[model samples]
Structures are given as structure tokens and as C-alpha cells.
Target chain A: MPKIVDHEERRKIIAKATWNVIAREGLGGASVRSIAKEANLSLGAVRHYFQTQEELLEFAMQLVQEQVTERIMEHIQSHLPPKDQVLNILMELIPPEEKKIEMQVWLEYISYKIRKKELQKESVHEVIVEILHRLQKAGLLKEDILLEEEIVLLHALIDGIALHILMGLVPIERGRIRYLLEKELNRIFVE
Target chain B: MPKIVDHEERRKIIAKATWNVIAREGLGGASVRSIAKEANLSLGAVRHYFQTQEELLEFAMQLVQEQVTERIMEHIQSHLPPKDQVLNILMELIPPEEKKIEMQVWLEYISYKIRKKELQKESVHEVIVEILHRLQKAGLLKEDILLEEEIVLLHALIDGIALHILMGLVPIERGRIRYLLEKELNRIFVE
Candidate 1:
């Protein structure tokens, strides 16, 4: 009997390898062949999953996004108070110890997009909007805030903090990212 | 007599060439040979000033800093009011058609630093603090703001805005960067 391969498992493995390649050598080094080598898969196997480097990169980005979403979903079920949940979700967007790879890979994707003169697909924007909607639904969003402006500001704040952390321009004190996250959250949300 | 060379002028020319190379091929492509070819200078001539690629990259960054300082000084001499002066100086830091090369090269340097796991020396920090001090001296700084946090926040905001511009994630509207800058300025300053 032929061995059965779990396609999802194989994909997750490939994406992990893609992130490793990006973190190790930047986007330039994450070619399909290199990612195949990193994943310990044959070139044919990698190509069977992703037809091109761009496809592989896009999947890698989605993997990052999905990891954040999964973590947030796991945390949201813990029955934390609404504000704390928002804090937790917003904080999750930044680099904690375990999330460092995700943040770095995400930045590499952004840098790649910059070099290509393309805008990212606004999925990150969607994530921000989704977070705000949840906050509003939970009655945690402040009434005085201009919703659109607040969203843009918080998006910029998240981008700034992540960039700072990845660049090592800011110290990675455990609570420092949370501190900034809370400060921005308070500006737009009622405690 | 040896060929007369103004060391400072040659250095500036090489730095300009360096920026062009970085803009064209990223930091990875700014090797000494390529930079020499870009500048149309002999490899020995280029090596006479910058002994290694690392030294050449560092000098390119310093050139970026000097260019910004020169522009700000010229703007300050225009005798605008302190608020307008601050606005002009801050705007000079972002891409304004003429400064796009500087912004791109500076970002490449930053991305290079991130990959190298180094912290930028505090020259940019000094510039931010200097601006805040001028604001206070001009009676424009808000009383309740935490100066240090505000400084860090403004630095991150400037960085975030520039990254957005370079990424084409944000439209390059002339007023857009200024809008973000003014929002942060209003947060920290009385005006």
C-alpha cells in the first residue's frame, strides 16, 4: 500500500521552512529550491505544493496570519474581561518570545512587497478592523474616538512597534510591547 | 604632483553613487566594486577612502545623516515661526520627491542593521530630542506629556511613516506624511 501524506501537515511543514529561510537569509534566499532544501523535501515535492516563489511566499504570510488567529482564538476563549481580551489580542500582534519568527517573516514579506512596488493585500488591515469590531461589539470601544482615524493610528502603532522590535531598536523587555499596546488601546478604548 | 582630489567632494560623490546602487540593487548589491563602477571611479580610488564594504556602507549612512542635517539647517534659516520651522524640519525627514533616495537608502541601511543584529547609534535620537527641546523653548510642548516616551513614540512614528511610504502601502500624497506628523506633533505640542 502506498503511504498516505497529510497535505495540510506537509504544507505547514513547508511554510515553517519558508519562514526559516526568510529569517535566515531574507526574502531573497527563500527561493523554491532553497525552501525545499530547508524543508527536507525534494524540489518536485515543494513544487507540487507551490508553483512559484511568489505562491510560496504568499502561503508563508498566510501561515503567519493563521498562527496569530489561532492563538487569538485560543486566548479569547479564556473568558477574560473584554478590555483585557482586546489587550491580549492587540499584544499578540507584536513580538513575544514565541512570536518573534512570525513577526520577522511578516516584515520580510512587507520588505519584499516594498521592493516589488506593490501594496500588501490589506489582510492586515482586515485584521485590525476585525479587532475593532470585536471591541465595539463587546462595548469596550470608546464613543469619543473617530473610528476610522483610530484604526489607522493603531495600525501604524502596531507596524511601528513590530518594526522596532525586529530591528532591535527597542529593548525586548517582556512587558514593553504590552505597555505600548496598552497605551494605544487606552487612547481608543474605554478601560 | 599627484592628481588633485578634494577628499570631501570625492567622498560625497561616492556616497551618492552608493545610494544609487542601494536604490537599484539593495544593500546586498552595494559592494565596493559595484559602487566604484557606479561612481565611475577606479576601485583603488574608492578603496582609498573606504577600505572595506562595511566601512563604505557606514559612510553611506553618515552621508544620509549629513544630507538631512544640511536640509534642516537651510530650512531653519528661513526664519519661519518655531511651529512652522519644526514642521519644515520634520517634513524634511520624510520623502519629498528630492529626498526619496535618502529615505530608500536609509531604510536599506536599517534593514541591513536588523539583519546584522545591531542597534543604531543615537544620532537620530539626538535629533528628536533636539526638536523637543526647541519646542519647549518655543513654549509649544505640552506640559503633561512624558518627554522620553513622547520622543520614542515620535521616532517610531517617523520610522513607521517612512516605511509605509517606501512600501507604497500608503499613497505618496504630499499631505499624507505631513498629516501623520502633524497628528503626532499635536499630541506632544501645544499647537
Candidate 2:
């Protein structure tokens, strides 16, 4: 009998390789062959896990989002205070030291999505809306602000900070920018 | 003298072609040959204007930035009130209908700059700092905010709003995001 490969483990391995390829050479470098080489697997082995490059990239992008969500959830759970929970969740979206490469890879994927129809699906938007709804329900968000506008602004702020942080214009410390974001959030929510 | 080719006019034509190529195929598709084809000019003609792809892209990027700055300056010269001037300048940065394509091309250039070394040195950063300084001088910015942090946040907000506007998450009306930004700015400046 042929050995049964652990499908989930294989997916994780392929996704990690995808992240590495993206980080080292930008989104253009995350080809099947490059990912295979980064994964230390043969092209056939990589294909055995992901049948096509598109499928591989789709899964890789989803995996990055999942990782971000998971980390945020973990941080939220650790913080008992509601304000701390919100702040911690926000921090998770920023580049944690271990996840800097992942964030960089994600940025490349986002840029690639701009011109490509297949990658422009609104799954990320849905996830963002869900988070906003959660915050609103928890009374963490100001009632006066339009949910959609607030959500859009939040996403933009995150993207902006990510870009600046990557460019080294913003320090990694969780002080000034964090205060600014939190303060803005407070302004939106009624006392 | 072969008509001397009107160097400034030729540069504008080349930059416009670069913009078209970016709009059509994105930054990845922006090449000398592609730009020449888009411009309906010979490869030699394009090469005569720009010696390298990097030089062409850098020039195109600078052109976009300058266009934005010029628009802002023009709006400021209308002699509006201080708040109106701040709002108008900020509104100009958002994807105005007349300049949507140019703004999209500019975003692509910024995404490209993420992976490539900047060719124009400190000019872009300096210009942004100057804008921030002007806002501060106008007493529209908080005195307590650190200049570096303010600049970073301002740039991020501009970029973030630009992304949202392009994606259609926010309304195209300059008044909407401008109002939100102005509110935030007021929060910072209002004693």
C-alpha cells in the first residue's frame, strides 16, 4: 500500500514555501517551480499537494488571512479588558516579529490583486466587516459613525500603517500610532 | 537640428505612455517596449527619451507626484478659509474624477517602489514633509504631535483613503472622506 500523506500538513508546508518565495522575490516570484524549490520538494511533490499554481496561490493567500485571524483571536482571548482586547486585536494586524515575512508576503499578494480579476474577490472585505460588527456589538465602536465608513477607514489605516512600517518610516513600537488609532476610534464612539 | 524633439514635451508623452501601460497591465507590464507601443512611438524614440526602464518609471512617478502637488497648490491659491484650504488640499489627494486614472497609476508606482530602490532620492519624502509643515504652520495640526509621527499618519491616511476610493468601498464625493479626515484633523488641532 502507498503511504498516506498527511494532507493538512502538506498544505501548511506548501503555504510556508509560498510565503518564503513571495518574501524573497515579491509576488512575481511565487511560481510553482520556485515554491517547490523553496519547499525542498520536487515539482511533482508540490503538484501532488496543489494541482495548479492558481490553486496553490489561492490556498496560500487564504492561509495568510487565516493565520492573521488566528493570531488576533489568540491575543483577544488573552486580554480580559474590553479595551485591551480591542487594542491587542489591532496589534495582531500589525507585523509581529515572527510574522513580518508573512505580512510582507501578504502585501505583495494585495498589490497583485489590484490588476488581477481572479484575486479581487471580496473575502477580505467580508472578514473586515465581520470584525467591525463584532466590535460594534461589544460597544467598542462609536455609535455615531457609519459602520461602512468606519470599516473602510479601519482597513485603510491598517494598510497605510503596514506600508509605512514596511518602508521603515514608522517605528515598530506600539506607542504613538497605536494611540492615534485608539484615539480616533474613541472619537467615533459616543461616550 | 532634427527639431530637437522638444525634450519636455517628449518626456510628458513618454510619461503618459508609461501611465497607460500601468493602467492596462499594471506595474509588471510597464516595460520600454510596452510603453513605446502604447505611446505609438518607436522603441528607439522611447529609448532616446528614457535610457532605462528604471529612469522611465522614476520620471513617471515624479510626474504623478508633481501633478498632485500642482493640483493642491492651485486649490490653495483659490484663497479659501484655513479649514477650507486644508479640506481642499486633502480632497485633491483623493481620486478626483478627472484624475482617477492618474491616481490609479500612481498607486501602482507606489506598489512597485515597495520592491525596488527609489530612484529619485529624498524628494518624495521631502515634499510630504513640506506639506505637513505647511499644515502645522497654518495651525491646522496639533502642536503636540511629533512631526515624524504626524507625517507618517498623514501619509498613511492619504494612502488608505486612496485605496478605499479606488476600490469603491467609499463614495467618490470628495466631501465624504474629506469630512472624515477633517474631523480627525480637527480632533488633533482643536484645543
Candidate DockQ values, in order, are 0.35, 0.45
Candidate that would win on TM-score: 2
Candidate 1: true interface contacts recovered: 0.30
Candidate 1's error at B26, in angstroms? 2.5
lDDT (Cα, 0-100) at B130 in candidate 2: 76
What TM-score would each prediction reach against the true structure? 0.77, 0.85
Model 1: per-residue Cα lDDT over B62-149, one tens digit each: 9889878888899889977776777787777666666777877776666666666675664555677799977777778888876766
The per-candidate TM-score of the B chain, in the order shown, comes to 0.86, 0.80
Off by over 4 Å in 2: A1-6, A49-56, A75-79, A117-124, A138-142, B1-4, B76-78, B117-128, B137-142
- Predicted chain A of candidate 1: TM-score: 0.86
**Every candidate's lDDT:** 0.74, 0.70
lDDT of 1 by residue, A1-191 (tens): 98899999999999999888877776655688998899999999889877776787788999998888898888789898766777777777776766788887777676556556676565566777788877787788888766666665676677776777676556446475577677777777775
Error of 1 at A177 (Å): 4.6
